[model samples]
Each structure stands twice: as structure tokens, then as C-alpha cells.
Target: MNNPKFEIFKAKNGEFYFRFKAGNGKIIIISEGYVGKPSCVNGIDSVKRNAPNDNRYERTDKTDDYRFNLKAENGQVIARSSEGYTTKVNRENAIDVVKKEAPNAPTEDQTV
Candidate 1:
């Protein structure tokens, strides 16, 4: 069976970003754009470090959807949900999945 993983890539604007994907290949979380790969990698590390801590997740309730951001100890957002969930329950479930799966997910550098 496929396991969850992180994929790093460069955007069309030449910024680097990384995304966490479930075993089913759906992108669950994505990092903000960085000027360099090193910073992007650091963001991935932050995600792995913080994903296991429920307190590090910041939940948001938008007008049309529920969303979340995973933050570092310094309050900087390391990554955020790729898409808002239709229901708060679904958002919470996705947070639970990240808490369970992100710590050990392998990284795949697709930038090259």
C-alpha cells in the first residue's frame, strides 16, 4: 500500500513549495512559497515537527468553508490545508489525519 509523502516542487513563478499528499494521492496540506529550496525544505521540516502536536493547528471558520493552518512554535504558518472542507467535522478529520501521518512521511524532491 502507498504511504503518505511530501513532494517538493518549483512553481511557475520560480518559488519553491512543498505539499503533503495522502496515500491516495490527494494533497492535504501545502506550504507557502519560498525564495529558495532550503527555506522550502525547512518548512517541510517544520511541518513534520509540528504535525504531531494538536495545539499547533489553527482552525478557521470561513463563510463558506472550514480551513486550518499548521504553525511552528514561533506562530509562523508552516503549511495550510490545500482546500477548505465543506464541514467542520471534515476539517477536524483532516487535521486528525495530518497529526497521524505527517511526522514520518517521506520527502520526494520533484524540483529536479
Candidate 2:
């Protein structure tokens, strides 16, 4: 992916979505899945930012009950809540986690 970067946005559903760009702008946009948790849009986070519910990654469009987790360059997590619902941890909580996990996170724009 060219010109890859972290982009955060709110979908029409009011749910949050983060996009991780690569060298060509190619990226993965992960959202909340059936497991009732958030996921990361980028690839790095898939490891460090695991779902609190099960610490797994899901790939499906049939349900927004799963999740995607992204990792900051510093090693923090950036997870997105499932659409149509919010997690008990909340965005702020995710942000705190990201801060803790990725202290020198270069992708601060992609908050967990």
C-alpha cells in the first residue's frame, strides 16, 4: 500500500472505524464483529490488541459481532467497537490501553 497511514472515522451508524494504510494506500478496515467486541483495521494490531472477550480475530460480513485489533508502532492496541452498539470499555478506555501498550506509538492518529 502506497502512502499508508492511520485514519479514524465514524460510520453512518455512529460506530467507529479505523483504516490502516500500506505503501499503496491498500489497507484493512476492521470493525466490531459477532463476538461483541472491537477489531483493528491495521495488521500490526491484530496481535497486540486482542479482544478482551476472546482475544481472536474474525473475518465476516454477515454479522458485526466479531472484531479487528490493530497495533501501534510502539506496541499498543487499536480496536473498534461493533456497529449498532458500544463496548463497556468505551473509546476512552481503548485509548488508554493504546497509550499503555504503545507508549511511543507513531500511529497515535490510530487510537485504540
Which is the leading candidate under lDDT? 1
Using TM-score as the measure, the top candidate is 1
Provide the overall lDDT of each model, using Cα atoms, as 2-decimal numbers. Answer: 0.93, 0.39
Looking at model 1, residue 83 earns an lDDT score of 99
**Model 1 C-alpha lDDT versus the unseen true structure:** 0.93
How many residue pairs clash in all the candidates, one count each?
0, 22
Per-candidate TM vs. native?
Answer: 0.95, 0.32
User: Mind giving the per-residue lDDT tens digits that candidate 2 earns over 8-81?
Assistant: 55566656565444334434334342221244334324433443333232222224333334434454444443
